[model samples]
Structure formats: C-alpha cells, structure tokens
Target: MRGDGSTPPRIPGPPVRGDGVEAIVAAGGLHNYQLELHAEYGPVVRFPLPGADLAVSVADPVLLEATAAINKRPEALFEFLTPLQESGNLQTLPAEEHIPWRRVMLSVLAGRPSHEAHFARFAELTSRTADRWADRAGDEPVELQKDLSELSLRMICEYALAGGLEPEEPGRVVAAFEDVLTEYLARLYQTDAPGTEDERRARAEEALTFLRATVDRVLAAYAERDDGPPERSDLVAALVAAGESPARIRDTVLMTLLAAHHTTGVAISWTLYLLARHPDAAERAAAEVDAVLGDRAAPDYGDLKRLTYLDMVLKEAMRLYPPGPYGAREATEDLTLGEYTVPAGTTIFYPFWAVHMNPEHWPDPEVFDPERFTPEASAGRHRLAYIPFGIGPRSCEGATLAMVEAELVLAMLLKRFRFRPAADRTITPIERFVLWAAEDIPMHLTPR
Candidate 1:
C-alpha cells in the first residue's frame, strides 16, 4: 500500500503500453478510467496521462482535506477553455485575479437577493417548457436533456441579461453555443485532424462571433433601460457597476451560460430519472411540494426552503450522478494526505463520482435512496463525501443558483406530471465536460 510517504502504487493497468495512454483510452475515458483505478489500487493511485507526467487520483474524503485549499488548477487540463477567454480562462486564473473575480461572481450568484429576483423568471421559463410537454400526447417520450438544457439556457439568459432575452433569442443562442462546443469538445478528445481541425476552428469562430454579438445587443438594451434597481442584481449590471470592461462582462456572461447550460439541465434530468425509477421517493417529493406550495402552480422563492424532501432528493441524485463528474488541483506545496506525502506541483485528480460511491461513506452506493441525505443520515459524514459541485475555491460559483433552479423545476414537473422510465431504453453516462447520457434520457410523462 506504500503508506510511508513513497509514491502510491501505480495502477498495474494493461501493461502500461507507452506512458499508459492506450490503457487509459481502453478504460473508456478519464471518468471510467479513474473508477477502475480506485477500485483496484485503492484511494490514491498513480497513473500516467498521455502527454503529461504521472498524476495522482484521490478518492478518499479524508485525504481530500489536505488539498482542499489548493488554488491552482492544472493549466494543461483546462486549456480547452482558452479560446473563450481573452483576459484569462476562469479555470486557470491566478489566485490574486481569481479571488476578486470569484468574489464578484459570488456577490451576485450566491446571494439570496439575486435568486429571489430571478425566481419568477425561472418559474416562468420552466412553465413555458412544461406547457409544451402538456401539449404532447400521452405515452410520448420527452427528450429530458434537450428540453431541460433549453429551459436552463433560457433561465440563465433571463437571469444574466436582467429583463430576459427576446422570445426568439434562446433558440439562436442555444444553437450557436452548441456549435462552438461541439468543435471544442472534439479537439479536447484529440479527434480533429488538420483538415477537419481547420473547419472546426472556422465554425467555432463563427459561433463565437454570433454569441458575442448577441451579448452586445443585450448589454446595449440594458444600457438603454431605466427600470433596473438602484442596486443591480443582474450579473451584467453588477459587473458593469463594478467597473469591469465590456469584453470582460461579455466573457463572464458567456462563461456563466456555458456553466449553467448542461449542468443544471443534466442535474434536473438525473433527478427525474432517479425519482421516476424510485416512485416512493418521487411521491414523497411531490407530496412535499404539494404541502409546501398548496394550490400554487409553482413554488415561490421562500417556499423553496420549506421543501425539505425535494432538497434531499436533489442531493442524493447529485451524489449518484454529479453534473460534472471530476475535477483536478495542482499542489502548490508538499502535503501529506493520510500516510502519504505528495510533492508540490503534482496534479491531484479529485474523482468525485468515486468519492460519492465509497462504501465507507455510502452504503449500497449505487442504489437510489433519497433518505441517504436526510439530516440524520448525513450528520458526521466526511465533508468531502458528496462533492458533485466540487469543493474549495474553484467549486461552481453558481451552485446555489443551480440548486434553486433544479428544485423549482423538479417541483413544477413532479407536481403536474408523473415521470416513468421508458421501457426498453438504455442510458449510457458519458463525460462530456459534464456527466451526460450519450443518448437522450427518454421518459414518459403522464398527467398526475
């Protein structure tokens, strides 16, 4: 086990075929690769990345505390985002810059005032999507991811832009954003060749231009409006009031959209999937919403706090299928994690899915059980045991916002419709910036 500060055992994976790149590929991407390594080699496993040095994977919550305060991220790992940032990629910003930027973000994103201000629009956007679903015939499958992604995009645009985007704006923004991401993700996987790479780059450029132009229009409209509060709650307004440049504000809005898009949608999708598969939990969640909302079509901001069971269900769902599966941190100083001492500059991979699956923390980890998050059951557990949104400084800035959105959407849908897993459908979870199903998560919705 090498408990004496020496390097942890290297995963004896598939004969190491040249820096273990081939082995990692064969293991089915980094998410599955880490799961296999942790299961076989224990909490901390050393493995080689294709073009990098040995990386350490940490699954044990206790060990995570040692690196919890790390402020640096592996630049190479986050290079995929460079194109989106002109000042700097948010993921790899230096601590001095990151702290202030994060402070500004948290001021708006994590504030109760900001959430309350946006809750009405969030509910409105959700209702619009649900209204479309209501029009579908019974037994028709709803494409959970696609529908919810658009819903999330709408919610974020409304929140970021202040008065909400035009009725036709979301579709164009969503399409352009997806076009940009499709090519960026392809490059991340090293799948683009010179010829195709150029094409992808061109497409990405066009899409980015469209997105920036859209943001410019929104900002221009904001400038021309007189209805904003003396103290701004909208992110763009807040950023501008703080004296940030137009380009910086635009980048911030785009980054927030990108972060919230698939993550919030997939989170809602997974929560629905889990609740559908576990009707008892779904019923309890619905009952809680009913009791709390009481004839109200959707929950008000204050009502969110009172929906306890819904909170537990969402937490448990995230434990099982975190929106973003994993994160990495670079050690700035030598640190000892349990019995092992890791050197500075080492890239420590926090495999959050594995951490959530640790039997020591979660009994029958794969089983969908909302009770796992009940206040009683959750007490005294490792703080890092459930890190779906990650931990420390680099955690999702909009986490509170994401949760508010998820709970509101879940309550509305479950209150009006019953979600049932479509028969004969298979869901394959893959890492696509976030953990997402390779195919749409199809579910039948019947009126409750």
Candidate 2:
C-alpha cells in the first residue's frame, strides 16, 4: 500500500502473452534476455518465463538477500532433469531431504582434505592435457571447451569414484555422460540437431542406464573392499557411510559429475578466452603463475593461495560469463522484496549473470577488470553481488573444489603457454546446461 492507501504499482514488464519463448529467442538467449530485461525495467521485474507462468527477477543484490533463504526450487523449471534421477530430482528435492543429501555432498566435496587428497591426481591430469597442448602448440588451434571439459570430467570421475574403475572405465564413463547431457540439454533448449527426437531420447536413455549401472559397479566394488569403508574424502564412500540408498547414491554421483565438469570447464575456458582478449591481464596472470611455480610445471596444494592475481582474473572472468547463468527458487511464503510483495509459490528467478552486471553494485560491469576483486575494492560490496555459484542453501556444494580445480588448471596452462584467440573463430556464449561457447573457444598456444 502507498501513502495514499492505494495498491503498489504492479511490478513492470512486457505484456504477458503466449509462453515467453519467442521473446527469449529474440533477445538471443536467456542470459542476454535477462540483461535487456533488467536494463529496461528496474532491478525487480515481473516477467513471464517459459517454464514458470510468471517469475520475479531480482537483479539487485540487496533485494536478493530477502530471497536467499528459499530452499525450494520450482518443479516445473527443473522437470527436465527428472529422467536422470530415480530417487528424485536432486535439483528440486524437498528441503527436509535435501538438507541431509547436501550434508553428505559437502562432507566430501567442500572439505580441504578431499581437495588435498585429489590434488596430485588433478595436477597429473592437468599436466597431461598441457603436454598434449604443448605437442600441438603450433599445429592447429585447440578447442578449449572440448578438451578442458573432458579433462574436468576425468578429474571429477577420479575424485567422485575414488579410482575404483579400470583405466578403460573412465573413457566409457565420460562418453556415456556426454551422450546423456547432449540429448537432455537439447530437449530443454529445443535445439535442432542431426538425430530424430525418438533416436536422441533412446540414446540418452541408454547412456543414462550405462551411467547408473556404472555407479552400481562402483558401489559393488566398495562393498567387497576388505579394508572397511573408504575415507570420508571419497564421495562414494561418504554417501555409503551416510546409508544413502543405491538409487540416491547413483543420482548423487550423476548429479555431481554433471555439476562439476561443465561448469569448471567453461569457467577455465572463459577465463582463458578473456585473458586472450585482454593481453595485459593475460600477461600479468602469466607472470604471477610463472613466479609462483618458479620452474615447476604445476603448483602444489599449498601454492594455490599465492596466485592472488590469477584468482582475481578467474573471478572477474566468471563475473563476465558465469557458468550457470541463472537459477530459480519458489517463494515458500509471502515475501517483501524492496517495495514489491511476492506471494507464496511465485517463481523467483536469480539471474546470476545480470546480478554480476548490475551497475549499481558493479560500476562499468562489462569491462574486463580484475582489480575490482581486490580486497579494498570488494570490501563494502554486497555479498550476493557476485554469485558465480548460485545463492544460499541450495548453492553448489562443490564450489570450493571447483575453484581449486580451475585455478590448478589455469596455473599450469598459463605457466606452459600463452594463449591467443584463433583468427577465424568468433567466441559467443550460449546457454546450454552451462554457459558454453557456441563455437568452442579455439586458441593458438605459444609455449612460454
């Protein structure tokens, strides 16, 4: 109510019409659509989103604080993920169940012991990729997304499964996961590719079956182990210790693999892409990596803390191009967002990309400046102003691990080579599961 005792002005937006798909398409993609939406309307805008009848998008970090406690995700928006999980859709799991599930996940993924335990293998894997790139340094430009995503998958496979699989198993596991994602994400975005709809669905189902069976195999192996349960740092072991059902365990592994790989892969790729475009920052980051490693190929676990500038560069790159561009939460009850009162069950969209670009919080938001992340500069900033990982209770459990992986990969790559954008390719970010380069980021590498 206003001072005059009238109702508050309805949140502004374009007139609601047929499912908002056409408008999203016209604006290029969801990320861009969000940028345009908030630029035209105020920070809080009510708009029709395809999956939800109507959604309130809050770009203001302060307003976002009001919605941070929401743990319920809109089922309709996450329904596409249902096929992959038998236990339930992990994305929209009810809070009572989700709380315990997240605890098990964090026990393994967010712990320092887990990161340290995995560091050697992570470095080895990253070094192997660096060696491959070094061999082809001048041959042809390397596809950053293609290769890095695969590397990230391998690293996560090793981390999540705890090396129970045979050498041949990782390759097959990566392939199966790729098949599942390619089909499902296509369905979500309605992309037209080579296969018929039935064919794609069939293939995805087959791949999903293989993935679940693979998890079962790992579980069986764990059961047969004579040396008691594996360590807490191991994801599979942690879940089993918590007495999660086989179906939930499988779902957890699948979701962890799904979440970890693409996001970390694209994050490193975008950081490299941005550095390639901004030579000065690239040079500075490289110099830092060189100084920190000091004739070593990669940094040890402890050395990661020293690469401050490179960390800033990675952060700013994510600010410019967040891996998961947006997330949604269903208001559990009536909520006040700034001046607007949102009713229960309303879909509240967290446009992470837009929030990062909000000029009120981030002045000259689009500029590729790493200094904005400096302690002095970041001092009084809103906490939610830079959520590369989504917000609050349902936020990614692997956030800590991801940073370690990305920084490790970036440190080694920057130490080994200087990357330059491929002359013939144009880099454009398109939303597919994760924010992906429409044409994979092609870069020519020069050995340092």
The 0-to-1 C-alpha lDDT of every candidate, in the order given, reads 0.84, 0.89
TM-score, one value per model: 0.93, 0.96
Instruction: Give the 10-residue window scoring lowest on summed lDDT in candidate 2.
Output: 185-194
- Tell how far residue 188 is off in model 1, in angstroms: 2.9
Runs in model 1 lying further than 4 Å from the true structure: 1-21, 50-52, 192-195, 228-232
Candidate topping TM-score: 2
Question: Which pairs of residues collide in candidate 2?
Answer: none
Query: Residue 71 in candidate 2 has what lDDT?
Result: 94
Best by lDDT: 2
Backbone clashes in model 1: 0
Give the runs in model 2 whose Cα sits over 4 Å from its true position: 1-5, 164-179, 186-193, 227-229
What TM-score quantifies how close candidate 1 is to the native fold? 0.93
